[model samples]
Target chain A: MKTKALLFASAFVAVAASLPAMAQQTATSPTLDAIKARGFLQCGANGNVAGFGLPNAQGVWAGLDVDVCRAVAAAIFGDATKVRYTALTAQQRFTALQSGEVDLLVRNTTWTLSRDTSLGLEFTGVNFYDGQGFMVKKSLNVKSAKELNGATICVQPGTTTELNLADYFRANNIRFTPVVIEREEENVAAYLAGRCDAYTTDISGLASVRASRTPVPADHVILPEVISKEPLGPSVRHGDARWGDIVRWVHYAMLEAEESGITSANVDSLMTSTNPNTQRVLGVTGGMGAMLGLDNKWAYNIIKQVGNYAESFERNITPLGIERGVNNLWTKGGLMYSPPIR
Target chain B: MANANAAAMDAAGGIGESKLMAWVRANLFSSWANTALTLVVFYVVAKAVFFFGSWGIFNAVWIGTSAECRAAKGVGACWALFPEKWRFILFATYPFDEQWRPALSSAIFIGLYFFSAMRANWNLRLPIAWIAGLGTISVLMWGGVLGLSFVPQERWGGLVLTLILSTFGLALAFPLAILLALGRRSHMPVIKSMCVVYIELIRGVPLISLLFMASVMFPLFLPEGVSIDKLLRAQIAIIMFAGAYLAEVVRGGLQALPKGQYEAADALGLSYWQATMMIVLPQALRLVIPPMVNTFIGLFKDTSLVLIIGLLDILNAAKVAVADPQWRGFGPEAYFGVSLIYFVFCFAMSKYSQRIEVELNRNKHR
Candidate 1:
């Protein structure tokens, strides 16, 4: 068994090593060709998650990740509404992308090495920098995770949050009991029923649960400590290098637009800006769109149609009561940084 | 008649008590232990009914918003969720103003089912009416012409989609199932083996795997520029799956028919097709109505599995509707409504099947 595993591991390494060389053989994207033929972009999205990607009561899709898909559509077709969304469960998302059912997956998927390398997928960039945190009742008078040494935590089984909870407590030399449930709603119900002292999940999920699931939002407080990094992003199929570049730059353009103070309202007027960065981003002076096989107004179209990263964040995530602590741009002491457009 | 019987009983002096009291004593108060058991059961059942009645109807918030429902949570059901989300649950992401299309289409489908269920309509007129009715439903749903806005199949969802999938699925599959059953019974070696292979191959796997393949894996096999509609793919998968299961039930029916019936048809110098169609099939099909309706109801409920493929069937639409931030944690109310919808359709099928069974078996009972 050990020898077979070693053989499989080495075979995987060989295949992984040859992927980049194979990717360089194609300068054009078959996915792009198909999208152009179909006259719309197919986006695999999350129908269940509230802020990241979900449909409203009218069946209209909205959210930060949804905006990413819209931005890509705007960049390509110069029309954000040209994208059609297919709501996918987590198990279906990767297979949907790999099988070419969707051009890209803009669901809230965490970027990990195994998924990146073994699954033949390319993580474009992180749109939401999330981390696991504990949410406890404010009446508990607990301000930090350190205080929950002997308390029971409610967590969903088969999630990274469960493993992280154990690692965090064991590393801190604190013993605690876990009330593990399979379904997330049941887990939250357990926490809300006082079956456990604390509920641990991603901070964004905690915020969503507290804001929407609980009776009173102010009664629950997310602890200060974030135990693990969860860089959620969009992904495309491996070896689709040109398509990967387009999806990647869509994220960066949104960030650059946020940093340059350009938004959907002001993008058309910012066409005559004097700054070189603004001119290049808005496609006034530089033919940057041609390099990615698009119209020169690609970035401008994205900004004009879908707005910048900040606008989307405020529009979607803000309603969920999530703060932009780590998702803010680099200028505000956050991790969201984009390379120069030129 | 009751008074005459009572006078006769009193004249006989068997018992002075009325019939109601006699029945009560015989059934409920026969002995001390039985009486005690009956009272204990009665108390528990009464308590349960009272509890549920209070929770589901009496104390439930019916004429208010989510806030009112939230306040009444854990104590009473939020029945108001139905009024608030019924449209969303029924129509899903279809255009709001155009929701009337699906509503009317669903009514038309139910009308067609009702018309087809009658014994008087079992003739060529039935098929003609069905075709006309189904054509009208398609036009109403798609609506490219007739001065109505065009809606694509992708936007089709909710109860309408569920009905379309199952109704068309079983309707198309029933004929195919009959053919496959006949083919399996064919005297030719190739035809028999082919039917056997097809049925076993499809029945070997669960319906979900086939749906997954159609939704997720089948696209890879298509050429780069070609793609089929996801709904069409899922519908085909469902029909194929139902065809295999229904074929087995039909084959069982064909096998159960007496050999003398087929021999009688042959003795009248009937050909193979005539013998099978006139003599064998009528008895065989009548014999298997119960099991065939069982498969039909099963297929109808199994349409909910399309939710996994991201199609907004009724169950998936309810899940999405309750996921709205304004109305979360009302899952029980939403699912109760969904279950009621499913139960109405399934129970109707079951009751209709029983009626047909008794109707056809009248001669046998005699």
Candidate 2:
């Protein structure tokens, strides 16, 4: 009887030890499965950033970051509207994604080495190549960021921008007073109320804050200098390589579509063209979509429904009078480049 | 003739004054000191009213874009933004086409609230009415049946989400609080200690911490692949937090009850449950009506804290509204609009609670 019980216990331990490996093989990417089962993509977004993810007067979310989520949804479900946005603050965005509260976080979160390694998150790619910049009143006559020596600058605490500010000032051998605030709005309000001579944040943030929060847009000027690299992107939990691949390729596909001039308006005409590259991207020639465990027409659906990277940029970012300087395609001498679909 | 003339003069200037003059005297200028103070206050108040009225009403830009608002700068409030963005502020990210569902649900909730406030509705039918009302609201908001389009709980926002969190939180908390109150007073040492620990632990933390735990930490404790909706998690946190405070209020009521009531029920051969339900709870609950309503009001306002965890309550929706590039820099107007809505709801609750308190205490001797 003792030998029989010991044999049963040994069998149980053997099965239990191999259970995780079997589970991993069966459900390769639970995030993708949950998303498909739910019939919509749960996207975390910045609720307050104007040109990034704020909602419109009609209660529809429209912005560059929002477009990335929409493109992902279009790629997965072939419907851009098949997405629910959870507006998360900077403090809550990571935990929301990590806890599976949101499938993808496309908030204007700066991708840093620490976040990538320690936060159990994988940043797909830089959707918006942002950089830290300074904004000051036009009346201040500070044409260059270097001119603001001994000035009181309002900045949000616990952000990469704060670190960048200190580094830039020390490098230039300039002295300045730091007026640290907790919230983005408070920093802007402090700047507008003349409590600070300048406000430092991402250039896109400066444009949005000036365009949306300033009483007069012409009153504020974003400085010409780009101090620190802030590559904002979509992120998913680590270990979901399939989900990460889908998000990464969705961005790449958009950029490739832009470089190839295959816009949403002309995707149908281009789909039937004799061009092998277009055929491959439209899924008539290659199995790129299948490699990501998606349908052949996934990239095609993304362009057809949510448009390319340029279209999203023009639609959401251009209204703030922001020129797509470094965000332009590689063909136009910008850094935006995509791997060929074939 | 001289006396009559003196009376006529008095009526115009002194003792037997006209009604309007008497009112002015009583309210504004009874004495020289009062007259001087009233005049100074009136001057300051009138100047403020004039400036505000001119800016908000007379010289305000009523219909235009942000460019137009800027053109009218230093003149008045940008009233045009309100009409353009009121829906976003009120319904938030609810699908534009399906906004009517949230609108209808809010109406039903308000109707039920007012119905429940009336003393005449305080009976068995009240609970039945509440159940029916809440069920209809759930069907309307969730919308997986009755041929209505399905709306998930995450899409719910603005005033509708606020009312749901508060109403449902209070509804679930009330009974749990009653049980906790009884448990804390129970003869069983284990039950009493458990109840005491729960109350103290929850009450020791702020609502924001509880919400943060619900949003961030709670999922870590759950097994993998099992998840709760963000709104539901916040609602649960609200219920738990409210239950602790409500339990204390209920305990206050239970402690105030006379010992003879328990003895009387025992003499009548009543069981513990029966004695508590029939003889103890009704009287104790009535005694704590004011405090109980005060707790409900606090819970209603505290529901706004869910926005910290990304649930779009009315206040958060207001922030989103002004964040729009089209209506930017209209923070004051947007906040004022939201505060008005909150004031209306909270004011109604305050008045109702006051009325209930009076009604409950009307027959009391002291």
Best by TM-score: 1
The C-alpha local distance difference test score for the whole of candidate 2 amounts to 0.86
Model 1 lDDT at residue B164: 95
**Candidate 1: which docking quality band?**
acceptable
**Clashes per model (N, Cα, C within 3 A):** 0, 0
Which run of 10 residues does model 2 chain A get worst, by summed lDDT? A2-11
- Per-residue lDDT of model 2, residues A1-342, tens digit only: 443343334335534544574455332455677899989899999887778898887777889999999999988888988998888877788877766678899998889999997677889999889999999999999999999999999998988789999999999999999999997767887898999999998888788777767877898899999999988899987766678889999999999999888999999989889988888888988777877767889989999998989999999899887789898888898889898787
**lDDT value, residue A101 of candidate 1:** 73
Question: True interface contacts reproduced by each model, as a fraction?
Answer: 0.45, 0.69
Across B1-366, the per-residue lDDT of candidate 1 in tens digits comes to 999998997876656456668999999999999899999999999999999999998889998998898899888999888887888889887878898999999999999999999999999999899989989998999998899898777678899999999999999999999999999999999999999999999999999999999987777566443678889999999999999999999999999998999889999999999998999889999999989999999999999999988899999999988887767898888999999999999999999999999999999988
lDDT (tens digit, per residue) of candidate 2 on B11-44: 7775535777778879898899999999999999
Measured by DockQ, the strongest candidate is 2
Cα shift from native, residue A232, model 1 (Å): 1.3
Candidate 1 C-alpha lDDT tens digits along A98-173? 6567889989999999999877788999999999999999999999999998999999888888899999999999
What candidate 2 gets wrong by more than 4 Å, as runs, is A1-30, A213-219, B1-44, B259-269
DockQ for model 1?
Answer: 0.35
